[model samples]
Target: MSFLNTLNLTGKDKSVGLLLGLILLSHTERTGAKDKSNVVQKGKGSTAKLKEIMIGRCFNYLGTINPNAGNKDCSKLWEAFLRAFSEKDPCKITKEDYKPFLNMADHDIPIGQSIFWSQTKELILQYTDVTHKVMPLENTLIGFMLDGLNWCGKLSSPGPNYEACPEWNSCTNHSMGSFWRAASENYAMKAQGEVTVLLNGSANAFRENSIFREIELGKLDSKRVTSVHLWIMDNIDGPDKESCGVGSVAVLENILKEKKIKYTCVDNYKPVKMLQCVFKLDRPSCNTGT
Candidate 1:
C-alpha cells in the first residue's frame, strides 16, 4: 500500500498530504541546478479561480451579451459542473458525466447561425468577429468560459487533482475530451434550420475522428436542419489540396448527401479571404483596387 493508504488517511488528510508533497517537490527542484528543459507542464486548477471565471462569464452571458439567454444560476451551474467529474478518475470520465451540467447550461442557438469548423479555427474566429452574424461553439457560454483551459479531478478525492490531468490521447474517456464531446453533442442536438462549417482547403479538412464528424454530424436532426454549408478556404498563395466537389471535400459532401442533407460548398470564400489579406494588402493579389 502507498504511504497514505498505510496511514489510513481519508478525505482531507489525503488532499493535504498530496499538496504538501507538491510543495516539497517544488522546493527540491528550486534548490537543484536550474534546468529549463526539465520544466513540468500542469493542467489548470479547478479552484476558486476557475469558478470565478466561469461564474463571471455566466453572468456576462445572461446580462451584457444575450439577455434573452435562458435563466441560469452561475453558482448552481458550477455545482453541477463540479458534480460531474469530482471524485472520478480523470481518464474514466465519460461524456455522460457532464449531462447534468450541459442540461443546466443549455441555451437556444440562433436559427441557422451555428458555425462549426475544423482545422481552421483562427480563420473562423476572424470570420465570426468580423461578421458577428454567426455563432461558433466557442462563443457559447460553456465554450466561452472553458476555452483554452484544462481541468481534471481524481478518483481518490472530491476535488480536482490540480496536479496533472490526463492527456487527451491517454484514454477514450479523457476528462477534457468528454466535456467537449458532451458539449458538442448538446450543441449539435440544438442546431436548427441551417448549419455552417469552415474548413481548410490546404489540409485534410475532413477528419474521420474529429468532434465535428464523430459527435456533431450524427447528432444533427434532418427534420430540424434545413441545409449545411461548407466554406472551403485555402491560403492566398496556395497548393490547393481540397475544394468543392474535390478531394476530402467530396468525402464530406458524400457523407452529408447520404444523410439526405442539402449543402453548398464555396472555395476560398471571398469575404473571409478578404479578412486574411488585411495584413498583406500590399501583396499583388491583394492590390485589386484599380
Candidate 2:
C-alpha cells in the first residue's frame, strides 16, 4: 500500500496532516536562522558596547589616578585593544597579543594597597567599597576594562562570536582567559611595598594552579614588593579548613620562602569578617568578631 492509503485517512485528514507538516518545517527553518542571526548580532553588539565604555573608563581612571596626567586619546586606546584579538581565532589568542594595549595606560598602583583575590570577589568589592584602601585588579584600568565582559572573534567573522565561545577549560589559549592572565601578570609586576591577597579560608586558600598562585604570585617582584600579606577569610558560619599554618596556606608559605618573598598571614581578618557581616547580618560571627 502507498503511504497515504496505509493511513486510511479521509481527504480532510490528509490535507490536515500536510498542512501541519508544512507549518512544522517552516517553524524549524525560521528558528534555526533566528538563532544563528542572534549569535552574530549579540557578539558584535556586545563587543562594540564594551569598547565604548572601556574607552571612557580608561580616561576617567587615568584622571583619577593621576590628576596631572592630562588628556589621552581614548580612541587610540580602543583601536589598540581591538587590534589585539580582532580577526584572530578565538581559541588561539595569546597573552602577548595584549602587550601593546597594556602598555598604553600602565600606571603605578598605590604602594601597599594592591589587593589580589582567588575566590573572594564579593568580599573584596565590599571591603574596597567601604574603605577604599585596597585596589583590586578590577579597580585598575585594565581590570575595569575587561572584567565581566566576554568577547571572542573568528578570522572569518566580522566581530566577536557571541553565540558560542570556548569556556575557560575548553581551550588553553581562549581569548578572554588569555587577556585576564596577561592583565594579572601586568598588575602583579607593578606591586610595590606591602601587597595583600584575600583568600577563602573555608577551602584550600591556595592552589598550585590558581591564577593567584600561578600567574600573579610568580609575577610579583620580590625586590619591588616589600611584603605579601594574606588575609585568609572564612564564611560567617563555618568550617574553616585553611589558615596561616594549615593546608594550602602552608604550601604557599613554603613557596614564598623559596622565593625569599617576605610574607604574613592573618586568619579570619577582623575587618574582612566585618564586611561579610554587612552582607550576612544575621550571622553571629559578623557581630562577635574581634
Candidate 3:
C-alpha cells in the first residue's frame, strides 16, 4: 500500500494528520526567522557533559535502579535519572544517562498523569520493576506533546482526543508500544522538509531504508532527528545472542558501520540492556527543533 494508505487514514486520522501537518508547515514556513524560532532549541548538555553522566552513573547503576534488584547504587542512579528527566537538568548525569531519562520522559510517561508534577514522579517509581520491570526510556504515549512534556514547558494532556489506552497492557508491550509510537510521531512532527516513512520485510530494516546512507549524503537533515534512542525489550537467550525479537543493537551497529557514521556509545546512565544503545548523530542530530 502507499504510505498514505498504510497510515490507515480514516476521517479522524486525516483530520489529526492535517492538524499536525499545519503545525509542522508553520515551523518550516518561518525558515527566514530560523535563527530565532523557538519551535526547536538545542539541548542543555554538551557532548562531554553528557558523557560524564552516562559513563559515570547510568551504566554503573544498572540493576540497582530496578528497585526490585536490590542494588542500592542502581536505585540511586535510577532516581537520579528520573530526577534529571523531571528537572530537565543533567548537572549530575553524564552522556549515557541522558538518553534513557529523556526517552522515558519523552515517550513512556502517561499523558494523563503528566498534569501533576508529583504524579509523573509517582508513575516512574511505581512502574520500575527491579527484577524484571520494563521501565520506559521514553513516554511514547503522549504523541505530539513531547515538547510540552518537558519540565520547562506548560504541562498538560495533549488534547481531549488523546488519552491513555485502557487495555494498554493487553496490547503488545502494553504501554511500551505507545511510547515508541509517540517518539516516532514526535520526530515526524518536528521534521522540516521531506520526511520519508518506509517498511521492509527484510530483516535489515535500516539497510532497506538506507537511513544511514541518506544521512551521510545530507539528504537526511540532521536538525530533525534530535537523538536516536532504542530499547531491546525481549527475553533474549543471552548477551550477544538474538532475543528472537527484531530491533537488536547489533543490527543497528552494522547499519551505522555500513553508512560510515561516527557514533559513540553512551555508557552508565541507564539500564544497558533495557535502555540498550543510544547514538548521537554527529551534529544537529538531537536538536529536534525544540
TM-score of each predicted structure versus truth? 0.81, 0.79, 0.21
Candidate number with greatest TM-score: 1
The number of the candidate with the highest lDDT is 1
Rank all candidate structures by their lDDT, best first, as comma-separated numbers. 1, 2, 3
Model 3, span 1-290: residue lDDT tens? 64446566778788777677678778877753642322223332122333244334433333333223232343343344444323221122233434454344332222112111111232233334332333233222222222222221101222111112223233232222333333343333333322222112122333423422233223323443333332222211212222212443356555545544433332211343232222432323223351
Which tens-of-lDDT digit does each residue in 110-150 have in candidate 1?
99988898888898989888888888888888787678777
> What is the clash count for each candidate, in the order shown?
0, 0, 41
Q: Supply the TM-score for candidate 2.
A: 0.79
- The lDDT of each candidate is 0.81, 0.79, 0.32
- lDDT (tens digit, per residue) of candidate 2 on 1-290: 64446666677899876676678789989877754543443222234577777877777777775444345567887788888877776768899998998888566688888899988898898898889898888987778767777787666556556566656666788788898899999998888899898999888789777899889998888888888898999877877788898999898889889888899999988877877776578777666644
Q: Is candidate 1 or candidate 2 better by TM-score?
A: 1
Q: Which ten residues in a row have the lowest lDDT in candidate 2?
A: 37-46
* Residue runs of model 1 more than 4 Å from their true location after superposition: 1-48, 283-290
lDDT of 2: 0.79
lDDT, candidate 3, at 121: 30
lDDT of 1 at 62: 82
